[model samples]
Target chain A: MSEQPTHHGDRPGSPPDGRPDGRPDSRAGGSSAEQPAVTASPSRPATSYRTLRLGAGPEWSSGQLALGAVSTGGAALFLVALYFAAGGFDLIWWLLVLVPVLTLSMAGSGMSLGFWALMLYGWFLLTDSGSFTWWSLPAAAGLLVSHAATALSASMPPAGQLASAAVHRWGRLIGIAFSAAAVVCCAAAAIHGRSLGLGPAAYVIGLVGLAAGVWLVRTNPPSQPH
Target chain B: MVSQRRRTTTERSLGDWHPTAAHARAVILASVCGVAAVLGRRPDLLVIAAPLAVAAGWGHLARPRAAVTGRAALGDATLREGGVTTLVVHADPPVRQADGVVTLASTAWVERKPASGIARLDDDGVAVLGLRSLRWGRHRVGTLSLTLTSAWGAFRVGPTDLPDLDICALPLPSAFDTSAPTPHPRGIVGQNRSSHPGSGTEFNTIRRFHPGDRLRRIHWPVSLRTGDLHVTSTFSDEDAHVFLLVDAYSDLGPREGIDGRPTSLDVTVRAAGAISEHFLRANDRLSLRTVGAADVAPIGVGSGNHHLRRVLDTLASIAPATERRDEGEHAIRGVDPMALCLVLSPLIEPTMVALAHTLASRGLTVIVVDTFPEHLVANPANVHESLAWRIRLLSRAAQVHSLTSRGVPVVPWRGPGSLDHVLRDIARRASAPRMSRR
Candidate 1:
C-alpha cells in the first residue's frame, strides 16, 4: 500500500522558519526559487505562414487561400459581365467588388446575408431598368459559388488547417444550387416563348406558390436545447 | 479521492429541435420573394429567388428528427507530465448534415492542440481534442462545450457546456539511480545487503559443514584442502524505510503550461516522485507526508510496485498551500524512528524548515533536498524585486547554515546522480564511531 500524509500547515508569504510557507519574503525577489529548461512548441509545417510574424499562431492554409481567390475571382468575373450588360461601370457599382473580399472577415457571421442581399438588389436594379438578358443566369451561379465558399471557410475554426472533405462537400452543394438556377432559367425561356400569360391562370399560379411556401414553413420544426 | 477512479461518461438528450435565424431567413426570404416575383410577372426576380426557394425546401425536407446525446471522455484518467492524451466526444444518433463543434477551455499546465482548441465533429458526430500536461497535480482538462447545427443551419441542438472532467497528471520523476548501499536496512525482502551473515548471494565466509547445511552450500576447493566439508556463508539482503516530507505551500514562476519551463512546484513534485520511485524499486518501505495544500488526502506507508503507483498518485494530488490552522506537528507525528527521512522543499517557508529541524533533533537520518528552481535568480527582470529576493535568500541561507551545523546534509536536486554523493557521505558517517551525550 502507498502512503498519503495529512495536509501540513504552510501559509503563503510567511517565513519558512516561523510561519507557514505562504507569506512573501520581507526582502525583494521573484517568487519562484528556481529556473527550469524551456520546452519547444509543436513544430508547424514548412509551408506555414506562422514564421512571417512573431507571436502568430496557425493561419489560413494555401488551399484555403486558393479557394478564397478562386471564389472571389469568379464573383469579379460576374460583376464585369454585369458591368458591360448595364452599359458601363458606375463608381458606386465598383464598391460591390468588395463583397467577395469581405467574405474572408465575415466568415461565421450573419453579415453574409446582407452582402448577398445587396448583390441581389444590384442585379434586380440592372435588369428592371435595362434589358433582361440570359447573362444573369451565369451571374447568379457565380454569386452562389462565392456564398458557399464563405460558408465552407467558416464551418471550421480559423486555426484549423483546410480539410478536403469540407471543400468537396461545399463544392457539391454549389453544383446543386446552380442546377436549380438552370431550371428557373429554363422556365423563364418558356415564359418568353408565350404571349398571353397575364390571365386568371397567372393569379392561380401565384396563389399556389404562396400556399407552397406556407406549407414548407409549417412542416419544419424549430431547434431547441435539451 | 474521486480523482483516483476513472469517470464513466454519461449523456443526456440534446432536446427537441427548434428553428434558428438561418431557418427563418431562408423560409421568409424565399416565400415572399418568390410570390412577389410571380405577381409582378418578372422572370428575373424569380431567378433571384430560385436558390433561396431550394434552400428553404431542402431545409424543411431534411430536418433532423432524432434526438442527439453527446458524451465526452478522456483517453486516460492519469498521465505523466509532458504525456499526451485524447479527449473524445461523440454524439449518438448522428445527424448527417449537422455541423458539430467541440471546444476545450484553456487550463493551467495543459497545452491544447490547434491553439483554438476547437475541433469539428466527423460524419459520425465525433471529435477528438489533444491534451498534453505540462505539470504534475490534479486539474480539470478545461470545459468541454458542444454545439450542433442541423442541415441548412435551419435548426440547432446545443452550444451547451458539459460537466467539467478532471485528470490526475502524475509527476515525471527526474532520472536517478545509485549503486551505493543504504545506511540502514531492516526488512527481510530487498536488494541491499545487510551487515549480518545469512542466506544470500554475496559471500561472507567459509566454515565447517553442519548437519543442517545443504550439499549445494559446500565449497569444493575449501573442503578438498581441509579434507572436510565447509559451507559458504553470505550476507542477507534487506529493505530500508524511506519517509518523504513534501512541502507544498508555494507555487512560484510563470505557468506557461506543458510547453514552457517548469515552476518551483513542478521541480518539487517531480523530485519527490523520483525519490519515491528509487527507494520503492529497491523493495524498501516508503511513506509520504505533505504540509500545506488542504485538498490532498492522507496516505499510509507500504512497499512494492503497487505502492510505487500509489506514491505517484499521491504526488499528483498535491495542491500548494499551507493549512490555516496546522502548526506542522501532525506531519511529523507517528513517523518511524529508524526510517530515513527526506524533506523535499524549496525551503521558502519556515514551517518546512522547522519540520526538518524537528526530524533531525529526533536523531533520525534526515536529508533535505532543495527543490527551488534556478530561473528566479538568473533572470533579474525587476531590480527592486531582485534585491528583495536577494535579502530573503540571504536569510534563508542562514537557516540552511544552521541545518548544516546540526549535521543534516542538504543537497540540491539535479536530474541523475543528485543524491548519490550525499547518500554515500551519510553511509560513511553512520559507520564512524561517535560518543553519545546523556
Candidate 2:
C-alpha cells in the first residue's frame, strides 16, 4: 500500500487526539499527540512530509547488464579500428567513446542511432577513400553486434531477462548480417585499384538502388474503415 | 485531449508496421553510407554499410502484418488468502518471430512471482504471471499492459492496456474448536442436547409412555418393574442460534496485510470467521452483521456448509469505518432472542460498546470478544504516543468494565480454545435460576 503520512488532525471527522467523540484524543490510528516542535536551520529548509517519493529506478537483470556490456564493447571495438586506421588516437576519441558507454542503459532509444552515426562518420573521415582496408570487416562486425544488442535491449524492460529462444534467434540474425558484410568486403577487396571504366551507369545504378531501399523501408499508411 | 491524442497514437501504431528506432537507425545509416560510397567513390564505406543494409532489409521482410490483439484472464476468480493464481495473457493468432513483454502492475497485498511483474511471452505468444494473494478481500488484479516488438525490433505494436480482472480473496480462518456446547440450542436440527424430551441419542429419564412416543423408545425392563407401560426418554437434538456482531468502527494499527501482524479489523474478521466455521460445522445456525461498514449485507440465520460460505463472504466484505454514523440499531434489530451474541471488536469505538450494552439489555447472552491487538501499545514510536495510548486504553478499560457490570462477558480472543471457558460459563448460567422482572 502507498504510505500516506497521517497526522493527528488529518482525518476529517476525528478530533485532534484521533477520537471521534471530541474527547481528549487517544492513540487510535497510532497517531502521536502534539509533537515537540523543531526550529528550522537558516542554512537548510525544513523537510515536508507530503513530498512525493518516486522510489528507486527500475532494476536491471543480469542478462540485460551483460547485453549492455556487449553493446559498449562493440562500439569500443569500432572506435579501436578507427584509431588503427587513422594511425593515431585523438582527444575527440574519448568523447566519442563515452557516448555509447553512457547511453548503454537507453540502447533502445535514438541516442544509440546518434552514437552509430558518429562512429561511422569518424571511420569515413579517418580512412582513405579509395583503398579498402581489412579492418572494415571487424568494424562491420562491431557495428552489427552493437545494433543487434540494442534491438534486443529495447524489446523488453531492463528487469526482464532474455529468453533462450530469443537469444538464439537474434544470434542467428546477427551471424547472417555479418556474413553479408564479409561477402561485400571480399567483393570490394577484389575490385580494389581496378577500374572497369563504366561512366554514369554506376551513379544511375546507385540512385535506383537507393530508391528501391526507400520503397522497402516505407511504412504503409493506416487503412480507413469504409 | 491528451488522452484522445494518446488513443490516436496507439491506434496508429497498432494499425501498421511502424519502424522502431533500431529500424530507423539501420535504414538511415545504410542509405547514407551506401549513397556516400557511390557518390564519393569510397569502397570501404560500402563494405561497412553492407551489413546494415542487409539487416534493414531482413527486418522489413520479417515485419508482422496482421494486427495483434491481447487479453488477460485469471486462473481463478476466488482464492483463499495466500493462494496463488496465474494471470495468463493470450495473443490471438500468435505472431511468430515477435518479442512480447507483459507487465503486471504492482498492487497491495498481491505478490508477483518475478517481483518485477514483467514476464516475457513464450514462443507460443502466451505469458503466464503468478499472483499470490496475501490478504483477504476483493481486489482488482494489477493492470496488465502488453507490448509486442516485431522481429529485429523493426516494427512495434501495442503497449496496449487490457481489461482488469478481480479476485475475491477469502480469509483463511484461524484454527479454532470448542468442546463446550453453545447455550440455548432451540431449533430441531443440530447435535446439541435440548431440554425437551424426544427421540435422540442422549438418555434423559424413564417415564410413562406418551401417545406420541416412538415404539423403539419403549423399555421392557422398566415396564416389567413398574407393572405399567413405560418408555425411555431422550433429550431432543437442537441447533443453537449464534449471532456474530462484528465491529467495523476503527481498524487500529498498521495495515501489514495477512502475512504480518493483523490490525484490529483483521483480528475481528478472522475471529468471526473462525467462530462461524466452528458453529456451522456443528449444525448450529449462524448469522453475521457488521456495525460500521457499508454495503455488507447481513447474513440471515443459516446452517450447513453453504451458510458457512455465506458467513465467510459477509466477513470478507467488511471495509472498516465506511459507515461511521451507524448506531448499530439495524444490526441488532431482528436478531434471534435466544441467540448468543458475539460482538467482535477492539473496543476503540464507543459505538460497539453501546451496541453490546443494547444487546445485553435485550436479555440476550452477549459475549464481547476483545479483538484489540496488544502490540499496538507495545514498542510505541514515541513517549507521547505511548502516553496517549495508555490514556486511551484506560478509557477502553472503563468501557469493558461497564459491559462486564451489565453481565456481558468480555473475553480477549486467543484463537483456539479462546471461547471455550466463556461458552462453558454461559451454558452454566443458562441452567441456573435467576430473578427477572415480569
Candidate 3:
C-alpha cells in the first residue's frame, strides 16, 4: 500500500510534532498520557477514487492509418485527374489538394462536404462544357473512393483496428456506389454531341429530372453485406 | 475447483440514433451538386455527383430507428494479487452494420490489455477487455464507455458511460513456517506439547501404570523386565493463543504493486497474513488488531481456514495513516493475557513503540517485527531525503534498542524462518524457573 494523499489530521500541513493541531505532544510520556481526545471520522470519501490520466494521447492503429492514407490518396488522385482534364493548374487547385490531406483526421466533419463541393466546383469551372472526357470516369472513381474511405475512417476510434468483416463490407458498398457513377458516366457519354431541342420545357424537365434523382437516391435501401 | 463469479448490470437506454456528421456531409454535398449539375447543364458534373447521392441515400435508408441499450459485466469480482479477469460490454439488439468501440479508462494498480484499453465489438455487439490487478486491496475497475456508429457512418448511438465495477484483490502471503512452540499452550486440540503428562504422540517417560491407563499405552518390555505393570507417558497436546498487533501509521516507499518492491505497509500486511496462516493451520487460536487504520475491524481469536480468510480480509482493509490520533488502547484493551503478542510495524511512529513497551510492561510475550522496507533509503530522490532517512533510522534504532533492553525482542521481517529463533528462545525462557523475593 503506497501512501495515498490523505485528508484530515495526517495532512502535511499538520504540526511538526506529528499532531493535527498545535497541541502538545504527549507521546514522550507514558502510554496512559499518550491518548488524545479527537473525534473519529471516516478515512476517506468514496468519490476520491478516480482514474488517472496517463501517458500521451492514443496512437493511430495500422488500420486507421491505412484508411487515412487511402482517403488522402483518393483525394489527390481526383485533383490530379481534374488538373489533367482541364489542362492547367491554379493556386486554388493547390489549396484544394492541401485541404483534404491536412484535414484528413476530420474526415467525418462538414469540412469533408465543403472540400468535395470546392473540388466539384473546380472541375465544373475548368472543364469544357457540352464535352465528355474519359478522365471524368477515373475522377468520379477517385471522389467516390475518397468519400467511402473518409466515412469508414470516421466510424471507429483512432486506436481501434478495422475488422476484416467490416473492411469487406465497406469495400462492397464502395463498389456498388462506384458502379452507379459508371452507369451515369456511360449515359452522359452516349448523349454527347446530340440535342433534343425541346426549347423552354428543358428547364422544367431538368428540374423534374433533378427531383427524381433525389427521390431515387434517397429511397434506395442500404445493403447488409455480412 | 474455483468457480467463476460474474456481475452483470441491467441494460440502460442510450437514447435514439441521430445523424452523424458524415451523413449530413454526404446529403448536403449530393443535394447541392445534383442541383448545380442540372442548372449548369453539365452532364459530367451529374456523373461525378452520382456516388455521393448513392451513399447519402443508402445511409439514410439503412439508418436504424430502434433505441439502443448497453450493459457491462465482469468475469470475476474478486481476485488475488496479480490475477487477471475480463470485462465484457454488450449492446442490446446487436446492429451488424454498426461499428462499436468500447474504451476503458486508465486506473491505478490496473494493467489493461492491448495497452490502449480499447476493444472493438464483434457482430454480436460484445466487446471483451482484459484487466490484470497488480496489487491487493479493494479497487474500482476503470469506467467503460461504449460508442456505436451506424452503417456507412451515417448515424451514431452514443459514447455512453457504463457503471464502474469493483474488485477485491486479496494479498498474496509470503512463505512462513515455524517449528518452535508458542510460549503458552493452554487449550486442547493442537500440536503443542503441554507440561502435564497424558496420552499424546510426544513420549514423556515410562511410569507405573495407573488403574485408568489405557492398555495400548502399556510398555510390555518394561513390564516384563520389572515383572510389574508399566505404561508409556506422554505430554498433553494443547493450543495457544497468538495475537497480532499491526501498525498502519504510515506506508513508506513507492507503491509498485505486488510485482515490484513492497512498501512498509505492504510488508506488514503480508507478514501478518503469513503469520496468521501459519498459526491458524496449527490449530492455534489467532486474533488480529490494527492500530492506525480505522477501517479494519478487529478479528477475534479463531482457528481453521475460515479464520484465516477473516484475518486476510482485515489485513486487506487497512488504509494507512487514516487514524493519526490512535493510541492503540482500543486494540489492546481486551487482549488475552497469555496470548503471544507479535507487533508488526515499521517503528517510524512513537505511538507504536509506546504500545510495544506498554504490552511488554504487562508481562506479555511481545515481539516486534520491523517491517521497514530497505529500498526506501537505497536510492533517495535527493540528499535531503537521504539525510532525513538516516536521522529517522538512527531514532528508530534507539527505539529498537529500548524495546530489547526491556526484554522484548525486535526482529526484522525475512520471509521464512523469521520468527523461529526468537520463538524457540521465548519457549525456553518460559519453561525455565525464576527466583522471586519472598
Candidate 4:
C-alpha cells in the first residue's frame, strides 16, 4: 500500500522472519523473548482476514481511528475558521490530505478495515469548511500511497513460503516508503505553499497518517500469527 | 483452597470486547462535530456525540475478567497399533462469539483444524478451528485465544483458559506368532513349567541324573552308578519376552494417510498400546524399544503394570528423528536373547530392515509388524507420484519378507483394526516345533 516509492509485496517489515510458519521468531537474531506472546489466534482454515488479536484492551474512551479523525478534522476546521475570522479569505494555506486507511482493499478479502479513510472522507465532505486546493493534491496522494503500503503489509505470501528473501526485502521497502512519502510530501507542501505556512492542515494529516502507519506495522500485516 | 471444575466460560469474553469500534466511532464523531461547532461556533452536536460514545464504551468498563472458561474431553494417549481414535476436544466457553482453539506440544501429531465451528461432535470447525491428535503419548490440552467483537469491527481479545486434560497413547506391540510352539510342552492351565523338572510341561535342559529329582525310575542305572547327585536344568513355563522394535524413522509417505487417517507412527503407537495391554493380561513379560533406540532403551522386560507404564512413557517422550539411520547407527539397540523381538515399522528405508535382521540373528525370537502398507503399498493416486510411492513401499515390504524368511514372523495388516489379529493369524499358520516327551 505504499504511495510514494511504490514499495512492493505484503508486510512492509514482516517478510524478514521468513519462517515457513511465519512464526514470530522467523525474524533473524530473534530470541525466545521476542516471540510474540502466544495467544490463540482464530484458526482460519483459509488465509484471508489476518485475525485481530487482543483481549479487549484499554484505549482512550474515544476509539483510536475515530478519535484521530475528530482531532485532526477539528484542528483543520479551527485553523481555517481562525484564518477566515481574521478576515484572511485571500490566504492560500498549505494543507495535507492523507487517506488514513486501516487496511487496503485486498485482492481476496473484504474484511479490511477502512475506518480511518471513512472518517477522513466524512470530515472532508460533511463537517469541514476548508475547500480543496491544488496544493493539497500531493498530500492526499501521499496518504493514498500510505494506504496502499499498508495493504501490501497485510498482503501475505503463501503460508509455506514465508522465508523467501524476495518477499521480505519488498516488505521493508514498502514500510519505509509509506512513512517517507508522508514526510516527503509535507516537505514539498511546506516548500511550495501558495498560502500562509502549509498551516495546521499539513501537520494534522501528516501526524494522523504517520501514526496510523506505525500502528499498522506494529500490529503486523494480516497474516496468521506464529 | 480447592479450584473446582468448570462447565462453561463463554459468556465472559464477548461481554468484555463488545464496545471497541462504536466507542471509537462516537468519540471521533463527537470530537469532529464538537470541533466543527467550535470552528463554526456551534456546541450542541458535540454533546450528543459524547453521550453516544459513552454508551458504547460502557460494557468494556463494566465487564469482569475470567468470564470465559471451557471443559475439554480427552482422547487416548497411546493409540493402538494399526488403529485410530479421535481425540474428542469439546470446549464449551460460556459466552456467545467466544472463539477458542486447541494446540499440542508434540510435533508428531500434524495438527489440523479442518472444521472451523463444529455444531456437534462430528463437525470440524473451520469456523472455530479444531485440534486433531497426530501422535501417541501424554498430550496437554490447554486454553485457546478468543477475540470477540461487535459487528462494527469494535473488538476485544482475552484468554479463555479451558479445563485441561492429558492424553496418553501407548505403542502397539508386534503381533505374537502364537504357533512358534510355545517352547512350553503343555501350555494349557495347571500344567505349569518349572525349572526343577519334577513334573511340568516344558523341557529346559538335560543334565546328569541326581537324587531328589522326580525318580519315576529316572535313568535308574546312571543314577545308581554315578552316586553323585545332579539335576536337569529347566525354567518355569511362561510366555517368552517379545520386544517390539518400532523404527519411527523417516515416515512411510507424507504425514497424512491416503484416507486422511494418520501417520504410520500414529498407527504404530496405537498398535503398541494394544499389544502391551494384551501381553500384560496374558502375564507375558513384554518390553518395548524402537529399532532405532533398541540398543539402549529396551523396555517391558519385567512383567506388571509398572513395566507397561514405562513403555508408554517412553513412546510419549521419544521424538522420531527425521535423519536416516541403520542397525549400526545408534548405541541404543536393546538386544535380549531371552525374549522374542518384534519390529513394528514401515521400513521406509532398507537400513531399518537390516537392523531387524541383526536383532533376529542375536538368538532372540523376532517378529515384524508390517506397516509399509500404510505408505507405498498401494497406487493411491494412480499418478506418477503414486506409482513411485508404490515402488518404495514394495521394496520395504520385500525387506520385511527377507527378515521373516530368516525366522522372524512378519504380520501385514491394515489399521482402523485390532493388532491382536496379527498374533492370532501367526498362531493359526505356524506349525508346532518338534518336542521330546519327558
**Which is the leading candidate under DockQ?**
2
| Residue pairs with clashing backbones, model 3 | none
Q: Give the TM-score of candidate 1.
A: 0.85
- In angstroms and one decimal each, the interface RMSD of every candidate reads 12.7, 14.6, 14.8, 17.5
Top-down DockQ ranking: 2, 3, 1, 4
Q: Taking candidate 4, what TM-score does its chain B reach relative to the real chain B?
A: 0.56
C-alpha positional error of residue A59 in candidate 4 after TM-score superposition, expressed in Å: 27
Which ranges of candidate 1 are over 4 A from the true structure?
A1-78, A99-110, A129-131, A153-162, A196-198, A218-226, B1-12, B256-259, B380-387, B436-438
C-alpha local distance difference test of each model = 0.68, 0.76, 0.76, 0.40
Chain A only: list TM-scores of all candidates.
Answer: 0.62, 0.70, 0.65, 0.25
TM-score result, candidate 2 = 0.85
lDDT of 3 by residue, A1-226 (tens): 1222212221211111212332222221211221111111122212111122224534566677688778778888888889888997786666666666567557666778788877888888899876677788788888888888887877776656677888998898889998998999889888877886757687788678767766654522322111
Docking class of 4: incorrect
Candidate 3, residues B216-313, lDDT tens digits: the string is: 99999999999999999999999999999999999998899866889999999878877887888889999989998876788888998778777776
lDDT of 3 at A80: 83
TM-score between candidate 3 and the true structure:
0.83
Query: Which of the CAPRI classes, incorrect, acceptable, medium or high, describes model 3?
Result: incorrect
Error of 2 at B124 (Å): 0.9
Report chain B TM per candidate.
Answer: 0.94, 0.90, 0.91, 0.56
Q: By the TM-score metric, which is better: model 1 or model 4?
A: 1
Binned by DockQ into CAPRI classes (incorrect, acceptable, medium, high), candidate 1 is: incorrect
In the order shown, the candidates' Cα RMSDs to the true structure are: 9.9, 12.1, 11.7, 17.9
Q: What DockQ results do all the predictions give, each relative to the true complex?
A: 0.13, 0.19, 0.17, 0.02
